[model samples]
Target chain A: MSSLGMADKVAIALVLLALAGQLFFQSARRRAPYSKLRKVNAYQSADLLISAVAEKGRRLVLGIGNNLTDQGASLSGVAGLPLLKAISRRSLFNDQKLQTVSGDGVLACLSQMVTHGAYQNAVAVELFQPGEAVLAGTTRFASLAGLLPEVNHRANGGVILSGQFEGETLLALDLAARKNILVAGSTASLGGQAAFLAGVCNLALGEDYYAPAASLETDPAAAASLRAQDLLRIIIAIALLVGAGLTIAGVL
Target chain B: MKKGLPIAVAILSGLFVLAGLIFQPYLGPYLGLVLNWAVIVGSMALLVAIASLIIYHARSILTARKGFIFSIVILASFGLSLVGGLWLGVDNPAYLKWVGAIQRPLEVSLLGLVALIMTSAAVQVFRNRGWSPLTVSFGLSAIFFLLIALGLLQTLEVPQIATVIGYIRQLPLVGARGLLIGVAIGAVMMAIRVLLGSERPYSD
Candidate 1:
């Protein structure tokens, strides 16, 4: 019954291992529909956006969703790098231009991944121009405003907003929709409010932002991490149920 | 060494931060000073971004691009704002008045313009994808609407409805918390990967 007992530590470690294993197997199989219940909303959105870009021959616009360096967690920014890589590869394969914009330095690191991804996909480095890959904006609204015109004029086939979006995402999505561009979005924070007003986009909530790379690349490490997350969720749920039952029985 | 330097710096800085957190009385002052340096670096980065914007836009204008006029306007506004803020002081009455006069109206108008755009976009979404796509969209949408409704009703003094809605909203917080805890564990593993040089963000 001790709070910091060996049993609890061992149990938690086992749960994490189990989760990692699940993710590894699922990613390796590549048969897991982006989610257990349904397709992961973000992956579905990315797929839809990619298809639209491929079909329309229009450029894809990706917003890293963090306008302030201080506002987002470092982990969210890191997670976004892989997603940017995957999206950039898809853009290159389709011979579509991928325009990325960042609001902070941490978010800007994603440009490296986009560049590498484009190169790995055998897209000419010249064609994958630096200016075309990453643009930085000063303020949140200013970045949204700057990207709005680009979305409107570029005839963007698809728009992907993932990372740490705020009120600006709704504005960008609204502009994209007006241009008849397909848009998909996800935010690591609760700012998914913007996704609601924007309407009918593939949006990921909280940790679901991590689902795309595993789904797309089937990378073993990423798969294992995702599996760990799933198992952790189950363990937490069981713990919650037990706590509730004990409380109800007045045993605590 | 090039790749290792960043990871090494990250570890040292991370340790400093942790020490500050755990041993605040002894290390707090130094951490505070370090954080100030972080802010200075952040400011430098912002300056770089602004400079890039100026260069990009100037080139576009010089080349007589289609959006040259707008670029000019942006540049002018940016320059004037910076000069005014610096010379007159942002807290000065004149500068405050200028901001008060311009900012709210500009923001309101921008919001209004985007509202119209949102309406058109929503109509287009319906026209292109129909109700099925609408129904299957992100769960965040439902949460957003619920929160907005709850906020509005609470302001209107509807306590009973607001209370119920608030509790329902809190239901997702539990799941969100669980997800966060899971993510924290994943982050630790990923950090270990980076520290062990298994995952390199800088390398191709």
Candidate 2:
């Protein structure tokens, strides 16, 4: 304990609790529990986009904004990776295609890898198009600007804006809305959540709420991760309530 | 070994960084070096990414794809900017101006678009609401914010109205700050998962 601060110990304890929770849920299969994650229409819209692409042979556009690195809040992009895996697998299964644009080159590269793996896992590696993931400049507007015109071309099925979006979110959301394309956005950026609430048809709001992949239960690993996240969230919420109550009682 | 080595490396490096950040011991030097290495590795990844990008666009141009013109433009811009940056150096005023010429207009256009979208969204706010209590609350709050933004509320000659707007604006601020904490929690959760090898984007 001397090797780390008190706060670090708290963080370690919490992570262990999360790991424990994940294990508990996975082990107790007969007594299944449900996560209290609210209904996010973005998951439905994502599912719809896959079905639409299959049914109509239309293209799906994926916008993973400027957040790509493994550092800091960029994990929001990583958090949304399961959706990409799911969509890529579905597209491969249905013999449809999807295009991805990213503000970060690293993200585009990783996304390509993810898509390739998804196709390979689905046993349709030949249909995997390596060129679908494009790095549309690092600048916020530059990325959106380059992708806006591309959407006009490939947008027939739908578009899902995921990852980290900030001030330039409205442009992408608004442009997608203008095209009358079925659009949904998922991100941890408060700006993204607000923009989606205002313009996009569906949304996954807070980073805490990116539990879409948990519902699918296709990947046990992802389910376990979601269980951990939900457990942590409940703990935090309870702590907040307790703190608030204690403060009211002049004991905080 | 392939998977095990990567996950093992990730967890050790992650722990080192975390411990250094918290403890500030001799391990801090190693943590700093690891971070520097991370940045160096990230920079190298950019080169690979660009090579892949160039290949993709080149194929489109070569195959005469429908958007091949855009591909040409992309390649040309990339080539020119790279050459100019090398020739003039990134810090040169001329190089900066050259890049800004490409950046400024796009930024302006996007901001203008956002403003238009915000206006349109506000105008059509109740179109789908069907007069539910929730819709009414949302619509009223939006209008209240809009009135404050437009200086319409200040025109009422009531000082107390300004106070109300001030308090109202802070509501979103407080909510945003709360969301920031939520974002931090989510980030920590994700980082821990990555470190534990429970969430491996790199692993197939």
Candidate 3:
């Protein structure tokens, strides 16, 4: 083993903290029968839209943005897969179609795989349609242009944007608005978050984008993850406060 | 074993990567190898996705689906681009310029439209959310930042006022850092989940 650098030490500490948090929450969940999750408007609205679309027998679209393979965004890209799995599990049995559009090739395949897994879990493996997950475009704008048709024509119920997206998401938001399709979105990108805040009121901003499984109650581990995030946030806030105090005191 | 195997592979690979990160001096070359493998696999996935996309568009055309015309246009463009890339070689300067010429303008125009749409969305935000605490703060902060960005605040040369402006200018960065920290924590939690085999997106 190599000697740990400061960054490595910090990384290890964070990982251990998360693991401890997860185990603590998991044990706590076993002791208590209830797990209360704070309500998020994005997931709540998405639930309504999914049911409404299912009732109307219209297609529901999930847009996994184009940055899945991007160096800085690979984790954000994979983060949406769990959300996709939850969504596909919920909506796959409906007679209405559940389609996914991705800007990146690897993301499209992963989405297809997740949907397939959902179908398998539901014992509807034969009904799984790989083509439902489409690589709309490889680049950002091309993906936006490719996605608009899906949003405008097929998303009769609504579209859920989850993944890393840029400001191009606004154009999709604009079309979804005009079409009267309910749009709920979450993006890791700050620019995309700003657009969502301005355009689509039902959005998961900042770290909330990563809490889909917890918000939807799809996985217990997801709930644990949420708790861990909360713990970390508190610790960070305290650290920042202390740092500021120390700086003011000329002791930092 | 089908489900178990993917989970095992995922957990092992994830742990290996984490270990490599923690032991970079000793394991850097192995990490590089694994990353190269990932790159290759990703490229192959891309190829498969492109093929599937072509099939999807071709099927849309054959079935005479609504807006199938767009699919035809997409296929034609793809075909032309493929032919050009193959015949002229992707490294050729002319080919690179030709692709860039089409790509750059489309991206720029879309960015312009997004700016216009974003401007409109500022109004949409107020209209839809209707002055809730969050929206009110968002609106005020947005206006505050926009005004500051326009250098309207710079005309105030008073020492106290300049100091306040300096403090105010740091607000965006502070907010951004807060968001980044939260996002980073979330990302870390996700990686941990994958490593622990608690949430398996690959198999389940």
Per-candidate DockQ vs. reference = 0.23, 0.51, 0.72
Point out where model 1 deviates above 4 Å.
A1-41, A72-74, A90-96, A109-128, A134-136, A193-198, B15-30, B90-93, B112-204
Ranking by DockQ: 3, 2, 1
* Winner on TM-score (2 vs 3): 3
> Candidate 2 lDDT, tens digit per residue, A122-185?
7777977777777777667767766787678753568887788775577666666777778877
Ranking by TM-score: 3, 2, 1
Error of 1 at A135 (Å): 3.9
TM-score, second chain, candidate 3: 0.94
Task: Write the residue-wise lDDT of candidate 3 on B18-125 in tens digits.
Answer: 778877888899999998888898899999999999999899899998889999999998998899999999899999999999889989998999889988988888
Candidate 3 stretches with Cα past 4 Å from truth are A1-7, A31-34, B156-159
lDDT of 3 by residue, A1-252 (tens): 446677777677877888898788877885442267665678778778777888888889899888876645458787678778888888887877788999998998888888888888888899987788999899888899988888887536888998888877889898888788888988888888887887764888767788888887777788877887888889878978998999999997
Clashes of 1: 5
Residues B78-157 of candidate 1 have per-residue lDDT tens digits of 89889999999988999988867976786778778766765555555545555675444534456466667667666777
Full-model lDDT, candidate 2: 0.72
Candidate with maximal DockQ: 3
Q: What's the CA error at residue A158 for candidate 2, in Å?
A: 1.1
List, residue by residue over B1-204, the lDDT tens digit for candidate 2: 956997888888778887777667666688888889877777776677788888988999999988799889989999999999898999999899978997788678778878888777755656732576856887888877777888877898798877887788899888887777667666665676677677776555
lDDT of 3 at A190: 86
